[model samples]
Target: MGWLSDSPQLLILKDCLARRLLSCHVYPELRNLPESAQGEELELADFSAFLAQEVWPTLPPSFREASFETRSALPDDLDSVPLDSTPVSFVDTLVSYGITADAEGAQTLLRKVLAEYVSDACAAPPVWSSTRARECEICEREIPLTYHHLIPRATHAKALKKKWHPASMLNAVAWLCRPCHTVVHQIATNEELARSYHSVDLLLEREDIQRWGKYASKQRFGVRRG
Candidate 1:
């Protein structure tokens, strides 16, 4: 109960309620309550009604409709506005929707939401851009990109049936240029790829891939490696 006072989202909610309904009352007046049990029940009912009618509609549909467990999974579509690069208008929009009263309040509330929801997937949404990378993620060459499935597609049916990999990762990919992409599959069989090198960082950890990347990065696009 006491901890509720420290919650930024709840505090924002309280502020919105105070601004709309209790502007005439002092802070102490809020603490003062009716002595009778019946009066307390009446007050509780009125507050509940106010929340149902006034506050609930102001929330985002996802926040309002989803259960906590459901909300815990990061949605495929997050606000494209990168969390690090959140503009003043982003905070303003949340405030305007009655989500928070100020930028600090908005940040606190959003950070909590992101921390809870982004766990199963990325720590946070991709920050550099919402669009796909123009350069190869492996060699960093500016060339046409191809999708390199982290868990190679050949293993998808078996992986799904065996639960070796989560279904969400079937489409997981790193954008690599043609040479680097060719080098990857050439170095590892599909089965070994699914087991050992499921991420770009893991692929980079191999000395052969690292050496190839260094060489391929200096060569022009489509140049064959000897």
Candidate 2:
């Protein structure tokens, strides 16, 4: 803990967890850093102050509070910190600090959260072809199809943190015609889309989307929905 205390690397880790940003394990720049550096920036002191003052303050009040609470929950006793002579692996050493059953519970929760974060960050983006689809997947109209992320990109960080969808489905998308695409967004909020209607099959299950798809399929390319 001494090596991490008041360090830029620790602050960055905390920031990632607080903001629900991709973890250092998956972030390319952080992962690429030399092991000796441990993801710390060159300007350690400046970076630490910046994170503590400028960056952390900009986060939501609730996030800041939560981060503070997690930090405060750690044991204050210097003797509780593991010794360098510990034979266990680094991670094992870190987790071994807690002597109580609650430590195991906390470890379980952390693993679940980290699993979701890493999976979402690792999911590949949809591979788009130079040639666009001739018809919308929804309405089957012969109009230019718009690429739509089933899980809205804007809500991705929050969605992953909320466990709305698994990492494998984060990059899922649908190609829809202009009208159908417009209606899809209009029909649900990003959270709702991530939680309930991410897949094309699920979108088709909605009466409004079904009705709109059928109506749009019959209309000519120039027709607009009122």
Q: TM-score per candidate, in order?
A: 0.43, 0.41
State the C-alpha lDDT per candidate.
0.58, 0.53
Candidate 1 — which residues are off by over 4 angstroms? 1-131, 222-226
lDDT of 1: 0.58
Best by lDDT: 1
Residues 65-130, candidate 2, lDDT per residue (tens digit)?
Answer: 222223343334423333223222322422342321344443443344333333333334445453
> Which ten-residue region of model 1 has the weakest summed lDDT?
120-129
Point out where model 2 deviates above 4 Å: 1-133, 223-226
Estimate, for each residue in 70-159, the C-alpha lDDT of model 1 and write its tens digit: 455445566542445445655664465454678887566555544343342232223323436888988898989888887898999986
RMSD of 2: 16.8
Report the error of model 2 at residue 177, Å: 1.0
Alpha-carbon error at 179 in model 1, in Å? Answer: 0.8
